[model samples]
Each structure stands twice: as structure tokens, then as C-alpha cells.
Target: MLKTTLGQWRMFRAVVEHGGFSQAGDAIHKSQSTIHHAVQKLEDSLGIKLLQVKGRKVGLTQAGELMLRRANYLLDEAAKLEAVATGLGAGTETQLKIAVDEVFPQNLLYRVLDTVSAQFPLLRIELMETVLSGAQELLEKARVDIALSPVPLANGFNEEFCQIEFLAVASPQHALHQQTQALSYEDLKSHRQIVVRDSASNSGKDVGWLGADQRWTVSHVRTSIDMISQGFGYAWLPVPAIEQELQSGLLKPLPLTQGVKRTAQLYLCFADGDRLGPAARTFIGEVRYQSESLLTAEQLSDSN
Candidate 1:
């Protein structure tokens, strides 16, 4: 049998967090005496001194510090329990917000979305196409329910979703392809390089950008592909995104001694995994299914 109540632990934590009984009471809309009584009863039940006081100042004892840690974890679990109950009671969500990095394969994304839509016809979905850290920012800010990003956000959970292959290429007729020898950094830097701008507002980043004498920054991968195919500049573009250009000889691979091909692993991250409703869970499952199916199909094609 449990001798202590969660209510007592809640009050105990509130006192420590707010720095005093009166402050805790004010914060929790309880009287100071009530808060003090709860904490006192909690300590009595636990048979330990949880707090110390000196001249109107309150601080936790050594044992109180450990108890406070456990109290925090307990309270967090309780909150998550409530959130799970609430989500289950709410049934399917009315809307789903998702942020997807531009690098993720469009075919796979579209297929998954089509499947999810068929399952939940009335569920509204707001899909934001982002570049680089844009998806991470949206997920971190709780603006999106889920995000696909190359790098996982700090203090969040993520699962490996897929790997995107980026190939450095230029137009077949471009001057760089005229060289017989493998291209060096100096050789590539002399020509114009096209780069996709990171879509994050405040903390955008640049990747796969060589310090070329001339550079063009665009907002989307398609824009970069279009510019590069027109012989305006050279850039590393995702293989799935530039398949037609590759097959048609519009874009030829740059023969770099190193980094000719780069692979980035994308992760599927949830803003709040525990609070995801039925719709979000369904979407996540479909994403996994579609990604695996695509990979398997591609492998079979390669094998043949």
C-alpha cells in the first residue's frame, strides 16, 4: 500500500519550484497553510526531512534533493498519463501538421499522404515543405506534429526514416567536364556554384556549398536543378529529384576525387510523441511502410 499521495508530491514540488510555501500557494491557487500542511504531511509519511528553513529562506535538504528529482519524474509521468487518456478519448485528430525536408523523396511522400488521406478523408493536413533546419525549427516550436529532418532536434526523439543520395553534377556541355583530369577544389571553385537556401528564418545553415568565386542562392531544390540544367551553375542535387536530368544527359556527374556522392540520413521526429492522436500515429506508420516499400522496390530494380 502507498502511504504518500501524488497530491502531496505535487505540493512538495510546487514549494521547491516556487521557492516558498506562499509563492507555491499563489502559483497553485491554494492557501499558504494548505501548501505547508501538504508538504509537512508528505515528509511525515516518507519519514524524512524534505526541506530546511532559515530566516524566511527555504531550501531542500540532501534527501529532499533526491526526492525532488523523483517527484519531478513522477509528476511528468502522471501528466503524460493524462495526456494519453485525453488523446484516446479524443479519437482521430481533426488536423495534422507535418514539416518535410525538401530532400525527402517526393514519390514516397505523395504515396504515403495519399494512403493516409484515403484512411481519414475528413482529417485536414497542413504539409509544409522545408529545407535544412526549417523542419527542425517547426518541430521544436511545436508548430508541426511531425518533421522529417537530416539532423534530429536537440531534446527530442527521432527514428531513422530514409537516406537521400546527393550527386554533384553539372551540365554535360559545361567547361568543367572538358577537363581530362579529376576536378580539384580549386578547379570547381572557379565556376559558379548554385546552392539552396536553408528555409529556417533565424538559424538557417549551408551544406554542400563550395566557396566558389560565383554563387547563386535559390529557395528550392527544383530551382537549383533547373538553373544547373540550364548550364548556369553546378550543384549537388538529390538523385531522386534529378533522375530525368541524369537519364537525359542534361546533368553529368562532376568527377571529384572525393565527395562525388554524399548520403544524408533523414529522421522522422515527433514534436510530442506521447501526445500524438490516432491520425498522427496512423500517418507515422504509413510513412514507415512506404519508405521500406520504396527501398525494397529500388533494391530489386538494382539487382536486375
Candidate 2:
């Protein structure tokens, strides 16, 4: 059996990347002959002509192209393996399971995740989208390493993260909007309320007004918004989720004489925030960076 080493593959990759043995030698600080010898040994072990001389440059043979493509990924994973090892040596966790409130804007969440994923490509991420107090429950049960919750837990480290605007809205054609005067809390109590159910396993407490004579409870915020759009009921909806709806005048904000529309304060709570590992810390940083944009509400039709 031919002995093929990581050093041989690395030298082969450098040659492919630099386009020639001499150039690869210049880049890796080795003699041109040494680079050529290592790649030649790699080709011999694999029984293939990995490179061919094309003018003053080197071109990958068909077999060489395939091997090189695989080598790139192999090298990436090797580098990641070392990163993970070094992180482990420095007390960094290899994986982090997180639960975030679904009320948080998905676009913002995706951006934060994208940034953090690049920072720790090898770190395993287990993300759970929760509603209301679901994230709190997950953390309580030790089911997640980190959590972003709208409600603060009685214990542990809790810090204000961001606020999401919740507009009291109804379809223009709805009965509530037909009134000429602004609404009172009593006025809303008479109309049907569209409510999003909590995602917690233990059943979470209902938020906002539950005193409506008629109410509809659904599992997701989208469903509640859909019902509101259909003129079935009125509910407080996130401005970001209904940006298109608000712009198109499909959903109009209800004017409240008393409380008006609201914003919920979401918090970053960790079981042990200070003692978190590098992976968790990096995730928190990414979240904080992307969250600022989400806090600034998308322009609604009018704050009436």
C-alpha cells in the first residue's frame, strides 16, 4: 500500500492553488523542487497524474480536479477540527443548543445565525423557535444552552435585549374599525381577539388582553395575523411580520384611547451568563449586533 500523508495532500493543494510548483514553493516558503516532489509522491500514491504543464502554468487533470475539489473540503474540515480542538482546550463547548422567542424577527435571527455560523462553522447549533415563555421552560429543563426570551425568569442573569412593537390591528373591513371614535379597552373587550398560543410544553400564561367576549387561540403568530387579515378578529401583531400588509393597507392599526399599541421587552437570559464558553459568547455577540436593526420598527401606514 502507498503511504499518502496529510502533508502530501496539503502540498498538492498549495500547488493547485498557486497554479505552479515554483509559485506554490514561494507561497509556502519551500524550494520549487520540494513542492514538486511532495505532489508527485501524492499522485503516485493515488495512481494519478494530478497536474499537467500548460505553458508556464500548471493545470489540473480531470482526476486532479476531482481530487483537488475533495482536498479543499478535506482541508477546510481539518482546519475546523483544529479550531474545535483548540477551543476545547480553552474550555469552549463544541455545541450549543439555543431557544429563541418566535416573536423575534426571523430575518434578523437568520442574519445573526449566518454571522455566527461563519465564526464557528464546526460548532453544532441546535435552534428551537419558541413562543412567549417557551424559551424559559426549555432553559429551566436544561434542554438548551442559551435562550432569548420575552419574559424574564425569576432567577439567573437577565438583561434587556430588544423591544418588538406590537400594533393593535384589525382588517379595515372589520367591525372594530367601523367605529368613528378611538377605541377604549372596553371597546376591544367586546370584539373577537385573535391570540397566539404559547409554545411551552408546560403551557405558558396568556399575554395581553384575554378579556375579549370572543377569542380565537392558534399555535403561531402567522395564523393569528391571517385571521386578523380575514376580518375574523383583532389582535396585536408584530410590525415586521406585517410590513407588506401595513404598506398595502390590508391591516390598519386600531387607535387606542388608553393603552395604545405596545412594545414587548425581550431579554437575553443565560443559566450562567458570565461562565459561558467561547461558542456561546460568540453567539451572544452576533445576536446583540443584529438585534439593533430589528429594534427599529419598519414604517407603518400611520401610528393612529
Candidate 3:
């Protein structure tokens, strides 16, 4: 029976990518002798000559080429198995993998994490910040236990939680800030703006202030905030995301003659609602309970 395993497959792939044992060893941070021994053992176990050695160079034999293909497939399958096991183990610890919209506040997320961890010390928490579409994809694929997304639930996933307000923000120095009345949606057309691009291919519409010309379009909210902070352009940000900036006098809300407010519904989405574990249920509860109050307070402070 072949004694070859995933590690040997990695060694084989490395040698092929790097061209020789010495180069592969250097690339993988192993000694040349160790790589040579591993390949030899793998070949011996399989009873096949995998390499043709020439003066100072090595080439793959027909068997080696075939083995390389199989090795890659094996490695990919092994990686998938590892990911599944890790996710399962995490579930047992009351751990949850959550994908959130990029515009959500980092501190608010940490607060929820802290509360959960304090309540369940053994809980494992994994948070991924992505666009609403990506978050939706993670939920649909069952890769994440829960997702906090701005997009509503029309795409078929169940919504377990939601929030109902949005904020339009700009640098304090922006021309729109000089308007004496509440800002209208049409007023946004006059200013240059930065916007978050939907990462998922099927996301039909763009969120926020979109113009015919996009000087800066980014996939991350953090990058948009950074650019806005630098005065590159104005953007409509979630209230929770720009609370501190507004409070610090770094940003100001534009006033319009006709009030133009947007109500963004934040949803907690899951692939199979019936299959949610205790950890996922608890985390979802925490998020639902906290989102409204947190967003309201931040928005109130920003308006002040």
C-alpha cells in the first residue's frame, strides 16, 4: 500500500512549482535533504519512478505528471475536509461564523462579541467584513452561520433580524454642508462621491449616492471612509459607521430643501433556518437585540 499522504502531495507540488528539491525546500522552508527523502519515500511506496534526474536538474516522468494531477486533487479535497471539521468543532464551542456588511461599526461588533464571549466563554467567534452581496452569498452557501447585511430578503433567504434607518454623510467642508435645510436626494448629484460597489455579480442596484461619473468606487466601506476622510469625496455611510467622525467635527450631514432619507433594512440571514445550532441562535438573538438601539443612538448623536 502507498504510504503517501497529503504532506507528501504538498512536497510533490512544491518540487514541481520550484523545479528541484533544493528550490522546493527553500520555498517551503525545509532542508533539501528532507524534501529529497520525502519524494523518494513517496515514489518507493507507490512503486513508481516519479522523477528523471539529469546533471544538476530534475524532470517529471510520465508517472510523476499523473501523480502531480492526483496530488493536487487530493490536497484540495483534504483542505475542504479540514474546513468542515474546523467549522463543526467551532459549533460545539458555541462559536459562530458571521459575515457582516462593511458599513457596520467595528466597535458595535466587538461589543456583541464581548457580550457573547462573557456569556459563553468557550464560544468561538469569526467575523468577516464584506459587502452586502458577499454576506448574502456566505449565508446562501452555508459558509457562515449568520450575516448582517443591508440588502432586504427578497432573494429567498429568511430574515431573522432588521434595522430601519440610513445616513448620508460628507466631510465638514463639503459644499453641501452649507445648505440650510434638510438634504434632498437630487442634491447629491452636484457633488463628487465615493461609493461601495456590490461584490456579488447578481447585485442589481448600487447603494448610496451614485452619479454618472464614479471618481472612486471601492468594494470596502473602510476604504470609502478613509477616502472621504481625506476629502477625496462625499458618501452616504451607515450612521453607526460614521458616528465618531461626525461627533469629532470631521464630518457633517448635508441639509436639503426637501428631506431625503433612506431607510436601509439590516437583515440577519441564514441558509436553513431550521438547522441553526444553539450558538448561531444565541448570536443572532444578540445581534437583533442590539442593532436597533445601537444605530439609533449613533444617528441621534450624529444629528446633534
Q: Residues 108-206, candidate 1, lDDT per residue (tens digit)?
A: 889888888899999999999999999999987778989999869886788997999999999998999999999977888889999999899896588
Query: Each candidate: how many clashes?
Result: 0, 0, 5
RMSD of model 3 against the true structure: 8.2
Worst 10 residues of 2 by lDDT: 295-304
Compute the lDDT of residue 68 as modeled in candidate 3: 88
User: Stretches of candidate 1 above 4 Å error?
Assistant: 1-86
Candidate 2 stretches greater than 4 Å from native: 1-92, 293-304
Backbone clash total, candidate 2: 0
- lDDT for each of the candidates? 0.90, 0.83, 0.74
Error of 2 at 271 (Å): 0.6
Candidate 2 C-alpha lDDT tens digits along 1-304: 5478777888898988898988999998999899889988888778889999999999999999998888877886676577556666777576788999878888888887787788888878899988999999898766887889997877677879888888889999998889999889899888999988899877858988778998888988888888899899999888778888899988999978865578998899876554467779988888887776444433332443
Tens digits of per-residue lDDT, candidate 3, 1-304, equal 5577778779878988888999999999999998899899888888999988867778899999998888877986676577567656656445578888876667767778888887778877888877867788777665787778876444446563555455666777777777776666676776778878886667755755465244577878778887887677777777667778879978766664543346666677765554566666777777766877776776898899
**Model 1: clashing residue pairs?**
none
Candidate 1 lDDT trough over 10 residues, lowest sum: 202-211
Q: Candidate 2 clashing pairs? A: none
